[model samples]
Target: MHFSIPETEVRSDENGSTYVAYNIHVNGVLHCRVRYSQLLGLHEQILSDLYTFFVYEVRKVTKLFYFLPVVRQDPILGSSEMFNSFLRKAQQETQQIPTEEVQLEIYLFSGQKVKVNILTSDQTEDVLEAVASKLDLPDELVGYFSLFLVQERGDGGCTYVRKLQEFELPYVSITSLHSPNYRIVLRKSYWDTAYDSDVMDDRVGLNLLYAQTVSDIERGWILVNKEQHRQLKSLQEKGSKKEFIRLAQTLKYYGYIKFDPCITDFPEKGCHVIVGAGNNELNFHVKLPSDQMKEGSFKVTRMRCWRVTSSVPVANGTANPSSSSKCDVKLELAFEYLMSKDRLQWVTITSPQAIMMSICLQSMVDELMVKKSGGSIKKKKRLNGSFQRSDSQQAVKSPPLLVGAEVFTKLSSVSLRGLSSSNSASDISGNDFHGNYAFEGIGDDDL
Candidate 1:
């Protein structure tokens, strides 16, 4: 029942050419030797086809064992007795374990770890509530915070992988990753920066914000000048958590989610840039080939629409064309940028982390809309397993800007084609563009 690919070995073919092969083992016994190219080829196949291929292979093995005697042969083909014993032991072990309750370790924004007990079937919402209860967070204010699956980097910085969805079981999702570096950290989730004032009123919330802000400064996520740093250190000594947060907010990229380096087709094509999302804008630090860096910002309000596109390099023939080799996926995040009152431009950025960029942008827009409506940020309501807007909220005049892959494909054929041709600002005015195309919300599925 235990399967592992122990190691890879270099081997020679009949033509005396060297290639690498993997030793696939099952329960300490070698089952098969697969070449690197073969594995790549298998991976290239579509998921449904690959599933069918595995099923067919299993059937063949089952039939071969069916006709064989019960006598033990090579260890590669495990004996029937041993197989049945493993199955029985597995069943017994499964039965002995209690699935009703499980212990989960959740981390706070300040790197504080706390353990809570919850049911195995508990969803993210239930787990969040349990964590909040442990922290004694007010019920009304619970919506201001969320649980995130974050990956801790070796250099002390951390990456926000994704926000845990309401429907997902946090325990199962974290366990399935099989990595210790990934942890569920509770952090403030509201878009409005001013909301931090409300959170600071509570002792626990104030400490959480202070810890996170200080961590961000030390981790170099927030930029602070020498004098500002000195002031922050003084505040830290005085235990001024509120003042520290207030000062930190004045620093560049404060409250922003930073993304890894990516390539953007802005100012010029294939410009390397570091992107950050926060304060209703996508901030960029473009690094030029001449070793110079230029700063820019894209406001969310001016973004007419945006979409994420992904393609496997192997399929696109951008990688090894003749050989079936596994290749990295290429992802592009394209947004309609308002150049002027009547002019729009399409800006595209290429990065493996494009989806995350899109999510952050959409989240920023959601928060902006909430702030514009003069209402408090509320948790998105889930109705029948989907998000539903409450009737109390005013309808947004502008259509949804965040789009998925399918809509991107359609837009590529129509809007892209139209936009490619040069037109005056008056020709494609804001009113004309908005009136012509209607968009829907990106929805929970994009997460």
Candidate 2:
């Protein structure tokens, strides 16, 4: 069967043979090939070969992703023993690189990895001594100098630096340090950690979080007032112990600060902050029980933040017990509230808030996939005798390789993600059929 494609020019050879070569992008990936044959009559052979090459290119691209993030985050994996084992197993499974040849290829590719060379400067001994004394100097920070360090080859030749006795050259500027001279050519991402040319696929949510910041939120909120405190004091004065507790809870819920009840008999829930932590402030853990708790006790359950009147419904439609609302809600509410008001505890996000922005991107991708698969709500029309109820069933009837491409790409990408870093969870969650989030973290750490 023929696939629809743009018109292209083709010319016949002297022997009456014809050839045409061009590029087609599938799922944000590309492949290039030129073909020649006696007669190209919807040639099934070409389709098969094209699919083969398509899969290979996809594997290579995905391999870059799988290996890249791992190397970046986990230093253990970057060690020679582990890296060499990885090469051995990968070559065996894919046969893309022969096991015997993997070392040479990896070395050849070493040039692309961040490199640094520390050449012997005048009176290099002191510099070498200082560098040697510096703990955990990664070759990426000082690899180019690896050459300068060695008087002879031991095991990995010039590429391996673990055996070096000292930093090869002192006075060579470390490209990474604030201003230390150690001539380091490390991957910019290793130091930069913010942007990567390889990671733009994740551009969506980051754009929004960057656009919105703390200052924007502060403008919208009104702080807790004296009247509310006055009302609370009236309850306390009347000896309405329960009423005072309830109001205290209300104030806390609204983001007003609350000290733990000082009564010795009360079972602790959370330690009281000896010093009040600022709104959304990342409070440090004291060696002692929190001031919020009894002198030696901890809170059994954290008191809800007084500031959040609302929270977003979860993706699965479950409401957080801490939130007042039960309905599925937009996450933007929490963000907006935090930005607008003061006096509620600070939001403790481990990473940049830009991640939430990517959700809209995910939705957009899902929509595009639905469109690409042919609009919502399929009109029930049958052609010939080959109708099927699901794409999975339809896939059963397509050519084996064509149907398998989905699996091939997924199998290659998932294992890397599932096993990698703290980011493994995000990798799996963000990877959808449209390939929108595939390589985003490959280049940068949101952390």
TM-score of each: 0.65, 0.16
Per-candidate local distance difference test = 0.59, 0.23
Global CA lDDT of candidate 2, please? 0.23
lDDT of 2 by residue, 1-447 (tens): 011111123535569887553221111111112232211321233234335433333334222223222231221222223332332232223222222311000011123322223322312323322342242333223211211211112432221111111211222212112332222221111111122212222232122111121111222111235886577568647855444434433432222111211211112223222211222121222222443321211110111111111122344644332222223211110111111112112222111111221122222222233333553322222334212234522211111111124322212111111101111112111111000111212212311
- Which ten residues in a row are the worst by lDDT in model 2? 101-110
Assess candidate 2 and give its TM-score to the true structure.
Answer: 0.16
lDDT, candidate 1, 314-379, per-residue tens: 335333211223333356778876565456778888876665676677566556545555656655
Error of 1 at 17 (Å): 39
Over 4 Å off in model 1, which ranges?
Answer: 1-99, 314-328, 378-389, 392-447
